[model samples]
Target: MNPNLLTPPRRHGERPTTTGLEIPHDQLDMFSPPRVRAELVKQAQALPGVFTGPSQVSEPSSLALRLRQPLGPWEAFLHPSTDEFGHIHRAGFLHLTLPRPLLAPLVEAGWAEQHPISLRPEWPDTIVMLYAPRDDGELDVVLAALRASWQQASTEKGR
Candidate 1:
């Protein structure tokens, strides 16, 4: 894996609004606001094998990314609610390929939930969706989890 994959103090992408984001307004909460969502998208885009576009968004407003290393779809967006054909997913959330050993602890800690490998058959192991952070403290925790997930994906690919 690249040692300098994602470092802090980096620039993020465009700010997500209630109109162009993939997630709907009802889904937004203090846990995951537009600012936080934008930050998450910015960070994810900083990693390798990530792309943002109409391929992930049905509309021009949707802010989402398609990752290749782990090979999955993720969104760090809100607003412009998700339509039936949209591939953009929840903001501040992640679906990752995690080992069963790791999954159990995350679930017990209320940090994650099993998302079923059926959603992404190409993945080698079971995946989980880490929830959006509820506050700054939770954002830190969520970022750590996301980093770990990205590491796992990179390691699996022998990057």
Candidate 2:
């Protein structure tokens, strides 16, 4: 990750608004689903800026990352929001979302952070959550890997 991409110091009340972004939640896959999910939870606990920790919601368990660099609570949450497509042929597939303000900083961090990932401008400022699985030549693995990576990446970045 590019260290310079970090958010610059902000003034007393300056907050960034959403410009545009491409977040891919349907293209992530992994080698092993359950194992990867476990690793994700472990990593989330180990990483910083992970509040409420990674756990199972009404659905599957997920890790969430929130940021508050420039305002009272400029936050973004990343967690498993949907299930695998049940059919696909790739790993590293996932569904993820973030606040519009976070787009610039995240993309500036690296190119892999940006790609075929889609967006929903219809929603409010908050990004809806999604999930992706790993591409172990199967759908389950892809979902597992995607979920784990999402949690791990958020934990890693927040640190």
Candidate 3:
């Protein structure tokens, strides 16, 4: 991990806008614009194995996206399953941007388990559900999507 790249910004009174996932000790310090942007790009581009290492199906989703590999599994579930070893979520990209500067803490909290961070970008904002997958394969399609989205985001941000 790149220390300079991943380190959170230091702001004395800065506080994380509380989300539903706030842990007792998990405090999101200040996040820089560049850092946040990079994370948005990196997290989307990161290989699944680097973060989670291996793949397993503990509780597969029942909603079109199931347990197995990438795209194929997505066509399997209709109802979210408890044993599905993937990330199942609704709309939530905005929440994801909040953690852009805190990669280490997010990983430690099991945010990137095995599900791709599902996204629904809206006008001026994107709603995404970061279904963290433990395996690299799970991120395949997501990464591709991210690449496409990133291109647009970068263009919009003037990268």
Candidate 4:
């Protein structure tokens, strides 16, 4: 991992903000600027066995990560995709995978939201539950969640 994770100048360290919630250990901006989003893509690329490319999802365009091998059944590793118009978000959200233990705490803590189930019902349970990062002050938490997914999909797999 990069020691100096090139984050936006929101703040550094685990400091408490107006909301009384300690922001992610890493600093982040209030929103996803192009540079900030590019940094996210860069981090995902640095992971082992991760290859960045167009999403496997049927869309006009989007970014996604593919593992060198399948994690059980899914090939996609992470989902911080961009839209066809080159917008980082069609809206202003991104999806990521997290283990149940991680997911529950993050949900209760208000760091993430469960992905829309109607989007893809065929996904396995391991992947069925996804989370969208909050742009408020949780990009780092979101990035950390994505990193965990990469670790599970790449290193933790039966490689």
lDDT of 2 by residue, 29-138 (tens): 22226645454445433434333323232223333332212121122232232211111112312233443445455344321133232333433233332223222223
Model 3, range 1-159, lDDT digits (tens) per residue? 222213322222323332433221112332334434334445643533222212132222111122222221221221123112222221212222222333343333433211232221221122233332223432433343333323332232222
Whole-model lDDT, model 4: 0.43
Give TM per candidate.
0.52, 0.30, 0.24, 0.57
Instruction: Say which prediction, candidate 1 or candidate 3, comes out ahead on TM-score.
Output: 1
Clashes of each: 2, 34, 34, 0
Give me the runs in candidate 2 sitting further than 4 Å from their true place: 1-32, 49-97, 101-124, 135-159
**Candidate number with the higher lDDT (1 or 2):** 1
Per-residue lDDT of candidate 4, residues 25-103 (tens digit): 1123334555556666676677776675665542324456666654522423333322111112322234445554565
- Could you tell which candidate, 2 or 3, scores higher by lDDT? 2
> Candidate 3's error at 101, in angstroms?
26
- How high a TM-score does candidate 1 get? 0.52
- Give candidate 3 regions above 4 Å deviation: 1-123, 156-159
Give the lowest summed-lDDT range of ten residues in model 3: 58-67
Candidate 1 structure quality by residue, lDDT tens digits, 1-159? 222213322213322222212222222332466677667767766766655664332344544444454422222211122211112244555444444456666666656555543244443444455566545555666566566555554443323
Model-by-model lDDT, in order? 0.45, 0.31, 0.28, 0.43
User: Tell me, what's the RMSD of every candidate?
Assistant: 10.2, 12.8, 15.6, 9.4
